[model samples]
Target: MSEDRISRDTEVLVVGLGRFGSALAATLERLGREVLAVETDEYLVQQWSHRLPVIEADATNPEALEQLGAEDFQVAVVGVGTSLEASVLITANLVDLEVPQIWAKAVSAEHGRILRRIGAHHVVYPEYDAGARVAHMVSGRMLDYIEMEDGFTIVKMRPPRETHGFTLGESKIREKYGVAVIGVKPPGEPFEYATDSTHIGADDLLIVSGDTNLLEAFAHRP
Candidate 1:
């Protein structure tokens, strides 16, 4: 497959309408991209009617995917993590069909490596990442967050009450906490990213990006 020929605007086919697939389909559709999702179960397909063009078909079948104009889509995601055989088959089909970019979800590191060997452009371990997120949420003071990469994360958190009214510089957050305040969401204004002059307000939600440990420590700060 010639991966370099794939266009950015090409439609995306997501195989599987489970949690990961459903969310990915919705996000791609919202981004103004054409998305075709496939699920083996009729009930699951019905549940995602409002999200995208979902079809009741087994993704492991190359013919089923070809019927949905799979050739027209440059990107595809195989999200059937529950069944290793299904995931592998779907990925192989996508690769054989010459889909330029294939992303497959794997249950483990070994599975992910195997998927990549079969032409998956990227392998995602959703279960492991989701577990980390759940643990972060369960730990009080960590409101919400996203990891931009292995080293950095952007988190939305309520600053400790003691830090209210403190300017970014005054608080010495960057030096003391080892976190960079990327933005602040005040009561009535939009979010403001780090600048020369930004302060922490009582009602503000600090939008920070830095080391994960720093963010976690800030979360537990009293």
Candidate 2:
């Protein structure tokens, strides 16, 4: 799904309260969004009932989803990945209900393809994504890495010495490195949006964005 699919005012319907589902629901709620979670396991329902709005029901059953008003939500997440059959069924039911944005978790490439063919608006491989992000972080100076669509990435990293004490325009970071410094966060101060006049400190953290390879090269600078 596109980034605009879920906004600050969106209420989410989360199916399958497993690890991925629970974390998604909890984080959404913590961020001040309303969430309704559905789980097949009674124990899981009971465990999270005190913390979130959860119900004990099988999401594979379209009737159950309808009874729980699944069709009423614009955004629905299928977090059942352990069993391929159950995951497919739940995603299909959401599709039948015509949910505007459906995000499904897939364990493998085949599973993701099936989910997309069956109308899942977005398919995420959490394990693979996390592994890739961690690999990038460990291999360079990046403290955080987010790979977006079409090989674009945004990273939080320390500024290289070549950029220290120079303004954005003076350093010509975009021209030389093929990347842009979006913002700078000096120690003990809030992050400020970068401009041509912005000066970077040696210890300041940078919010950089560009193509994945170019960002890697920029972040790897000594």
Candidate 3:
């Protein structure tokens, strides 16, 4: 989906109230978007209904989606990944409804390819993404990490001792370590945008960006 595809003021239709679906719907609501969630499991529908607007229904049936006015929604999210048949059927049904932006969750590459073939605008691998993010955090000084396309990454981490007490220009971090320090947050101050004259302090937090392996090497420094 394009960056401007989903506006904060837009209403979203979410099918399947599983862990991923419920979390996404709740987050969208928190972000000031109206969300209408549909679920096949009665218990799940009931459980999440109090948190957001939800109804119990089988989304695999195109007729059911038509009744629910799915076509009226500009964005639709199919969060059924456990059952491949169900996932594919729901995504296909959304396509038939002509939902302009469809985001489907896939458990495997094959499922993702199928969703894309059927016109799903976006496919998410939540499990794999979460595992990768956790793997990075547990193995290094990184407090947080976001892996981007083409091996690039942005990380929040503690400053290395080699960088302590030196101005960015003097340290030449990007030239030496191959990672750019984008921002810094001292122990109690607001985050500061990084500049050539910015001094690296011992206890400051750093937001760094670079190739993933280079980031790992930089973060591993003493």
Q: Which candidate is the best by TM-score?
A: 3
lDDT (C-alpha, whole model) for all candidates: 0.85, 0.94, 0.92
TM-score for each of the candidates: 0.86, 0.92, 0.96
Deviating ranges (above 4 Å) for candidate 2? 1-8
lDDT-wise, the better of 2 and 3 is 2
Output the TM-score of candidate 2. 0.92
Superposed model 1: Cα runs more than 4 Å off: 1-8, 46-51
Could you give candidate 2's per-residue lDDT for residues 1-222 as a string of tens digits? Answer: 455755667789999888899999999999999999999898999999999999899989999999999998989999999999999999999999999899999999999999999999999999999999999999999999999889999999999998899999999999999999999999999999999999999999999999999999999999
Error of 2 at 75 (Å): 1.5
Candidate 1 has its poorest 10 consecutive residues by lDDT at 1-10
Better of 1 and 3 by TM-score: 3
What are the C-alpha RMSDs, in order, of all predicted structures? 2.5, 2.2, 1.5
Off by over 4 Å in 3: 1-6
Per-residue error (Å), model 2, residue 103: 1.2
